[model samples]
Target chain A: MLATVDQHDDTSPEIGGIAVDRLRSIIERVERLEEERKALSGDIKDIFAEAKSAGFDVRTIKQILKLRRLEPSAIEEQETLLDIYRRALGM
Target chain B: MLATVDQHDDTSPEIGGIAVDRLRSIIERVERLEEERKALSGDIKDIFAEAKSAGFDVRTIKQILKLRRLEPSAIEEQETLLDIYRRALGM
Candidate 1:
């Protein structure tokens, strides 16, 4: 009776034929990660603020961080594409 | 003894004078997040593969996902800036 009284969950709600508990676990983990990511992003924004105070372009720093994650060949390919696009646009 | 060998941990490795255990916890948590992120990324790539098989442009989908996270005003500002840039370049 106590267990029944305390349990309003799982009447098991399934989503798209997936087991609800498993789907809920995945959703919860993703939500948790999103929260942590938001916090870490605030930390990153603070670092960008520090960089701005030191007279650095935070946007370029952001691009640099993005580029650092790419392979050299990938970066070269992107740059070449950008060059072509710029030339085509008369920029 | 088993206890002695098992207990050899803090012999505490410090970095930059920060408390070693606290630093280790932060590093370990970040490392855990990185690992989970990598795994979740693979899941996202699988979804992208599914999208590609369904004849969707994944890069555009990625951009849409990015845009969805932005405020409407921010999106408008970006569009305006892009239009200005395009006009400036004779695009």
Candidate 2:
């Protein structure tokens, strides 16, 4: 029965139909991930704006985001700098 | 004349006036650097848009920019990836 399904080029058997369903599921998963990514992007933008309004440079915020994603340690270094700056400014 | 001017705490000598002028120049230079930074930021945004239109993720572009700023070699790595992707896509 499996051989017969494989032999048919145009209409394969139901058992072989799993591949198509799997492909559809994969595409749907990718679509959902993309949607989630868009939402996260908006949240990041809001954070940048908030930082900018607080007298922080938005470019630095963007850089910090990138650095945080690529190098977690870099973020810690930046936080240390922020702490020092705040202390110096008595903030 | 210089001693007389320096003796007056309120109105310092012309020789001491150079310090005030130097401080003004430093402030002006910083202002110019800030303006240039703003213009460069807009240019980077445009580059991100171009990358997005080319099917590249803007988030990746932002990361690339950050990495490039922090680690110059990272940009080369990204360019290598771009080259491989382009070749694989036959573009």
List, residue by residue over B4-81, the lDDT tens digit for candidate 1. Answer: 112345675544443445333433444454556566566655656655554445575557666767899999999999
Q: Write the per-residue lDDT of candidate 2 for residues A1-91, one digit (tens) a residue.
A: 1112233555432233233333445667999999999999999888878888999998877776678686678677777766644443345
Minimum summed lDDT over a 10-residue window in model 1 chain B is located at B1-10
In candidate 2, how many Å is residue B32 off?
24
Pairs that collide, model 2: none
Per-prediction DockQ comes to 0.03, 0.03
Off by over 4 Å in 1: A1-91, B1-31
Interface RMSD, prediction 1: 17.0
| Pairs with steric clashes in candidate 1 | none
TM-score of each: 0.38, 0.29
Q: Determine which window of 10 residues in candidate 2 chain A has minimal summed lDDT.
A: A12-21
Off by over 4 Å in 2: A1-18, A64-91, B1-91
